[model samples]
Target: MPVKITLAQAMGTCFGVQDAIDMALDPIYRGKLTVVGQLVHNPQVTERLLANGVRIVERDQIDSITTEAVMITAHGASDSTKADLQKRGFTVYDATCPLVIRLHKLARFLEREGWFPVIVGKADHVEVKGVVGNLKASAVVYHERDLEQLRGHERLGVVSQTTNRLDKVNTILDAMRKLPWVREVRFIDTVCQPVKERQAAIATLLEADIDLGIVVGGRNSANTAKLREVIADRGIAAFHVERPEEVEPRWFVTRRHVGITAGTSTPQDVIEAVYQRVREIVAQPAAADHA
Candidate 1:
């Protein structure tokens, strides 16, 4: 019997990620540019860029960079950081996603208007760090327990990491409204549309008769991990893999209907590669024996 494969309606890299990758690979700067961070969360994309002679360095290692120019990742950077780079005499190339830029602007605008800025995202995430950097006062909260930091403040201004789960963002928002000390609350929705659509698509894909899900993206990718979490939340078996070689044949031996989804930073070609691998796996006789 031929196993059936279904793909989520909305999956794979968003325009912002794609644009950043294009800029990094552009022939004009391929050899001269050094990206300040992983251009995107996907290792495959990173490897491809490296193969094309692009240089990537960690934020802390920027001091070691000898390149005359540097590109910011899609996650973005604080204005101060950009200014400092320019002050150091390096030509700066910004690849900040427009949505992330909007979040930074909204947070600053809120602070200017007398609201205490509160960002909803993982405190350590590069994107969140960019938004929180240089702010006079800000609190990063990903759970209810973190809300305690927001107390003693009368007014709060909130924005979220573009890749944060909408449900989590809403839960935090609702809880903030109930805090007795918070006299005034202002919120600007910062979750990007691509994330929202992928989330909604996964929910729709779960309604299908698939016995398992394959989530493709880099292991460190926050959005990719969230896709796997969503599948697990629904009690569906899932395999989250970063490469086609990681898709084991054993996963499909007993699964006739498999659903495939990918994180927003995952490339289209990567998704297709995984799909083709799945087809090849299911087509082999005694597929489980290859596992």
Candidate 2:
């Protein structure tokens, strides 16, 4: 049987991520640069920066960085973090996605309006942490169980991580509104447009009769993980791989029709490589074994 591959209409790296990568690889900052975190959540991007003499330091390890110049990742940093770095005599370069910066402003604006800010996102995510760092009080919730912390607040202002799934965010928001103690629920749509487009594209792709789905991106990418979750939720066999080598030949044995997608941070070359690998694997007659 011949294998047919379908690519999603919208996928791969977004503009904000590309802008950050360009800044990281800029010749002027090449030798003196230290990125405060994984610049865009892709290992390939990280490797490229390292090869070009850029240094990467974790958030807590900023004090250990010896570089005179530092860059905040596309995920962004709190105003205080940037101020402290400047106070420490380091030249700060901001590569925060414009959308994420909007989220920060909206969240802060909500806080200032006498609304208890509630972020619908992972508590430990770098972007979430950055937003929370700017606010004195806020609740981060991803599930119905996390809504307990919002019980006592009179008015709740909600915003989501830019890359969060819209469906999941809506679910959490609906749950928040159901809580008896909550009075006013004000919400802003903060999820990035790229993420929503990708999600919508994946939904459209899945409408086809695909035997399985392949999602390419960093293992830690929240948006990439959500794409896989969407595929799985539709009962399709979903394989999430960061690189071409992770694509298993055996998985395609009986699956003749494959749907492909990539995360916002995934590089185009990486996505193409994965797609080509799948083609190569399915070309082998023995690769079609049911085992």
Candidate 3:
């Protein structure tokens, strides 16, 4: 009696992550280039890049970098940060996702047009930081409560971190519509297509009658967290795990159907490992009720 296993259509690493790793591993960059940050959020991916001779410099320890050149993460960095790296004698290899590049430009353009820039994301997230850092003054908000921090600006400009949940972005957009004193609101939809598809896949998973959701990705991955959050909001228990062994057998005690999804930063092998572990748990004859 095999338990049914379902996988999301848009699961695993996106093209952006793949491209970043490819560029870093290429002969031209392999020995000479250092990455300014984790190329992508997945630990496995990071480890692989490290094995391939890519040096990663964390933001806190960025000053210690001695490489002649550095590759920007797929998440991107501010224009000033790029310029500063050049000034420090390191040639920059910008691996910013094209979609993210668009948002960075949109934020600057809005500021140039006199609209106050606002970012919908975690303030400390590297991607959001990069976006806001491009502007002299900008606001970052993740919820309605954060709106209180907004300075008095008659016109509002909004863009979101590419990996943020769409519902969250929409909530912020709706809030922007209600600012009575604001004369104008301009928003650019910068959410990535892969994220949107993965988010929508959550609904399909729930409709399929899965007892639980297993989200595979790095713990620091924002998009992966969003996947778990979406499933949990629908009242189904979900586990965000980086590897197969992280899935506890206790959780599968009575689960006959399980849904699996992976974040954009997750690699394909991690998802398969989790799926295999789920199957192993369900095959236990002694654990009669366990699916």
Candidate 4:
């Protein structure tokens, strides 16, 4: 029998990521540009940019930048951070996704409304850090257990990382809504549309007869990790891999149906490569013997 490989309809690079790369590699800023952080979460994308002459600098190393132009990655930054970079004389090119800008605005609005902004995401994630920094969040939580650190507030607002899986964020939001002392729980939806679609696509695939799933993206990609986490939590076998070479024959030996999902930062070509690789692996004569 032939192996069936299913690719998520919404998988791979988002508009924001392509725009960032375009601006970074544009002739206007070529060789003279430096991104304050990784242009996107995918290492392949960043490596391509770096090989093409884009320079990367950590946020703390802004003052050390010798370039005349700096690009703010798709992940975004606080208004204050942008101002500080401009103050130092670098021509700042903001490649922040418009959606992320809107998300930030929402967080700020929640804060101004006297709602304690509770971020549902990894505290160390670049997107989460920017959101928290912009909103001046006192604390952020990814799970119900982390809520113990949050004090009882009359009104609480929750926002999630743009690339986070909605199922995970919804789980956290559900827990927040059930909190006893929280009179009003404002669950703001900051998860990006593409991310949500990809996650939903994954869920649809997981519901099928697939023996396991493959999530393609950088290991450092927060959204990819969350998708993998959610899929595994559903009792499905899933692997988050960055490249085609990472695929193992063992993962598909007994599996006839394979589900493929990619993070927003993952490039389309990478997804294709993984898809083809899986098909090739399962075509081996002995592949289904273990099934």
Candidate 5:
């Protein structure tokens, strides 16, 4: 009588996350290793790295440490960060997603061609920071109101943070066209496909007859938060939990069918554990009711 649990086919870690982990574990002669930020924004993944003896250091602490190698997260880092690390005598390990790196390169190329670069993403995000860092003159616009800050720009080039919502990027592009001075606006659709696919897949899952939704990922993970938002938008009960222990019994009280989804950064094992926990939670009441 255990509650039925269905996991999204596209759930769990993407290629970028997988690549970052492999790079971190590769045996290289990095005198001392330091990671710029939460490598994949998953505590369990971070803990695994810690167990493997990788040091996760803060941005400010990077300069003070004498590590021979410093890894930029999958989210990527600004050019300034890489320069600073090198200046501090650290060998840089670029673990940035290839898609993000491609966007950075595109921004630099457009800047050289006399196009004012504009990034459609969270200004504070590491990936956006890296993209902006490559630009000599650029603007970061997260909303329609922020577009008003643009000045005297006829020719503009746009790129987005790889993790940004695709619809928001399109809306921002539409808004940018309304600017009077904008003569030509070229947009590079750089939002990562894996991230978009996961999001779209979750949206499709939500349309089905599901009782409750469980989203798994780190609290600080932006993409993970977006997945939770999508589920909550359906007005169904949804919980964002990082681990199996966070699942509550009450969530299953009236739920005969539960849906499970994980962020791009989440590992497969974590998702499985969450599913097993959900099954156990749903089974308890049915067992008691029968008794």
Candidate 6:
């Protein structure tokens, strides 16, 4: 009467999330630490850090904090944000993933050279906001229809939010190339490898014999939302939950196989908890049927 639960091979935290946590826990800045944003978009991680005495501060409140050093989240920030913190006499420990920093540098370089930068990302995401806020002449393009709005720009430089879907970026680029007055279009693929790998792994899961999908991460996490969106696109029932308790028993009633995938920011323990809960639900039916 025992039930079986299988987790995705590549589920849990990515390198960027690991790096951010490591940087935050570095010995030098042990006492009186403040993070500019949610460290990596996992509630459990944030809560753990909070219990450890790390303070999470909003962007506007960083200037008001009295900490010796403030950490930036893995989702990279603008140069201006760092400059502001430095102006306030706080040593800034940048926890941004190297890949995201690379994209920020590319955006600045392209902008300085007179190329209008086009960022393919959600406008409200903290990472995209930081990226766009740094640029002097850049625009955030979320959908393919936004392409028509770029009627006057001659030279276009394209970069994507580090966690965006590669296929979406490619589709947008292909559409931009068809614009009549657009002279030259150059795209720097900025999608993080971890995100791409996670997405691809989920795609493979969709093709498998799974009845439902469970995605775990912070509610405000853009990448996590995208993961849910990707799974939902397959027309299968998918639930994005932060913790195991959020899993609904009804979702598993008739399911023979359940696929579990977590975002880059999701912790290993949370994934295991989800699996354990699913197994618990499955076991009930098996027990009754056997009885």
Q: Model 3: per-residue lDDT, tens digit, 1-291?
A: 566789987889998888888899897766687899788999998898888888998877779887788988999998888898888888888999998898899999999999999999999898998998899899999988888766478899998999988888998888877877777888888898889889888889999999889999999998999999999998899999998988888887667788999999998888888888888877874563643
- Writing each residue's lDDT as its tens digit, candidate 6 over 1-291 gives 233455776767999889898778776666678999778888889887877777888887765787888888988888888898888888888888888888888888888888899999888788898898798868888788888768899899999999898988999898888899999998988898888888888878877766688888889777888888887887878899998888877777666677888889888888888888877878788543453
Q: Assess the local accuracy of residue 265 in candidate 5 as a C-alpha lDDT between 0 and 100.
A: 92
RMSD of each: 1.6, 1.1, 1.7, 2.0, 2.6, 2.5
**CA lDDT of each candidate?**
0.91, 0.92, 0.87, 0.83, 0.84, 0.83
TM-score of 2: 0.97
Worst 10 residues of 2 by lDDT: 282-291
Where model 5 places Cα greater than 4 Å from the true spot, the runs are 27-31, 286-291
TM-score of each: 0.95, 0.97, 0.94, 0.93, 0.91, 0.92
- State residue 209's C-alpha deviation in candidate 1, in Å: 3.4
Model 6 poorest ten-residue lDDT run: 1-10
Q: Write the per-residue lDDT of candidate 5 for residues 1-291, one digit (tens) a residue.
A: 467778887878999999998888766733357788889889999888877767888777765665668898888888788888888777898888888889889888888888899998888887887788777789999899998778788988888878888887898899899889889999988888998888878877776677788999988888888888877877888889999999888778757778899999999999999999887877798643443
| Candidate 2, lDDT over the whole model | 0.92
lDDT tens digits, residue span 1-291, model 1: 678888999999999999999999999986899999889999999998999889999989989889899999999998888998899889999999998898999999999999999999999999999989958899999999999999899899999999988888899999999999988889999999999999998988888867899999999999999988888887889989999999988777667788999998999999999999988888784865566
Candidate 2 residue 25 C-alpha distance from true site, Å: 0.1
- Which residue pairs overlap in candidate 5's backbone? 68-91, 78-130
Q: In model 1, where do residues sit more than 4 Å from their true spots?
A: 289-291
Candidate number that wins on lDDT, 1 or 3 = 1
Worst 10 residues of 4 by lDDT: 282-291
Give the Å shift of residue 234 in candidate 6. Answer: 0.8
- Looking at model 2, how many pairs of residues clash? 0
lDDT of 1: 0.91
